[model samples]
Target: MNNVRSKICGITRVEDALAAARAGADAIGLVFYAKSPRAVNVQQARAIVQALPPFVTTVGLFVDASRCEVGEILDALPLDLLQFHGDETPAQCEGHGRPWIKALRVRPGDDLEAACQEYVGARALLLDAYVAGVPGGTGQSFDWSLIPARLSKPVVLAGGLSPDNVAEAIAQVKPWAVDVSGGVEQAKGIKDAQKIDAFLRAVRGA
Candidate 1:
């Protein structure tokens, strides 16, 4: 089998996006949710996307954003994929006519398998830890065992992942990809270059 891919989300700066691409991140995510401290304006995100090297995927993240909001950003910036991190239905997600990854917050006793089935046609299913009063960007990990081995779609593990434990997470869960936000950040929306390099190295080693 091939090595697990990883994404560095909540990117806010051109330097950070460059660092993430250089560090071998499969994709770099830019938050567009206005409520998020990590959110970036279209111009800022477009600059960062344009600055990246070829083949480095740029991902746009939204939290129940309106169609107009998503359309406006897509029209302005170059994005390879869209990630829906809120209570968006499959129809709403697919209506945009862009490939998308749907994030599902997993909690104890939750049926991950069934949830994946519910979001049919998603490019990938991102499994994030369930935290009270937190929508996303909470660097907390859920039980790997909570995920069933059998699923209809690809699984992308998110929540709390870092250089130290990513290898273990990969070995155990065998997810198609892993995503990190706060784990590689200097602040809520800022990414650390050293941490980004280390995290990518760890994923490669796994």
Candidate 2:
């Protein structure tokens, strides 16, 4: 089986971040959007980032945030990657001096190839479920069949992923990586250790 990387997103505490790293997650996401229940302040994010051991990627997630806000967070945190989860223009995603990925909420009749082409400079594209007025962390699955068999860039599958269904998701999507937030959470912003472990095991088993 191909190694499918796992990212534990919506990290708010140092302990949770450490737990994820200890569980062998490839990356941990820190939510920067204030509206998100998992959102963290600069101090929280900084502490979590500092607590992490070497080689574990730290990703900062934002939703339609201004350049100034993003810059401020970048100055405070040593995020390894940026994940834009809003309707950000391709040009807006560039020139940040950091590799970034654009998240697209998949819906029926959506032309994914064209969308990927628009964000050609992205390091990868993350696919998530679309809910009215909800940005992400919806914990709702989309139609996996909506994804194309081929793409110009790598794909990171997200949305409604848990240990139970992650193996099936991997089999179908064959994404480069899988991102999960609410799936392993005991509540909003609180991660469950057993769930995290099971999620990793499922990815490996797949």
Candidate 3:
């Protein structure tokens, strides 16, 4: 089987970031949105990034934050990628001098292809479950059938992904990558090493 990349999101500590890397995660996401329970400050994010081993990508996740706020975090850390989890315009996502992925919360009757076209500059489109007033990390699964078989850009499957269900999700979606946050967590922001290992194993086995 071909390799499907994995990303462990909502990492708050250096220990968890290192754990994700050890568990063979391709990337570790640091939540920068203040509303999220897993959100991290600049110091915490920097510490996690510094502790990660070689070849593990560091991603900074933001909500609908201002350009200045995003710039401040970018200036402080050596993040490999930026993940915008809110309603950000294409222009805002671009001109940042770093690659970015835009997250779209999937809802019934939504035209994903058209939305993808609007955000044509994104490196990939991350599909998550849509909850009223909730940004992301909802730990809820949406209808996988809503995704089109072909997309102009790559897809990163997320939302309610755990060791038990990830294999099935991979078979169904066949996304370029899979991102998990609450799925491998001991609690809101704390990562469970055992869960992380099991999740990776499931993905690789699939």
What are the per-residue Cα lDDT tens digits for candidate 2 across 1-206?
A: 56999999999988889889999999999999999999999999999999899999999999999999999999888899999999999988887879999999999999999988899999999999999899999999999999999988899999999999999999999999999999999999999989999999999999
- Segments of candidate 1 deviating more than 4 angstroms: none
Model 2 misplaced regions, further than 4 Å: none
Which residue pairs collide in model 1, if any?
A: none
Winner on TM-score between 1 and 2 is 2
Which ten-residue region of model 2 has the weakest summed lDDT? 90-99
Q: Give TM per candidate.
A: 0.96, 0.99, 0.99
Query: What is candidate 2's TM-score against the reference?
Result: 0.99
When superposed on Cα atoms, how far off is each prediction in RMSD?
1.2, 0.7, 0.7
lDDT of each: 0.89, 0.94, 0.94
Clashing residue pairs in all predictions, respectively, total 0, 0, 0
Task: Give the distance in Å from residue 41's predicted Cα in candidate 2 to where it truly belongs.
Answer: 0.6
Error of 2 at 158 (Å): 0.3
Model 3 spans with C-alpha error above 4 angstroms? none
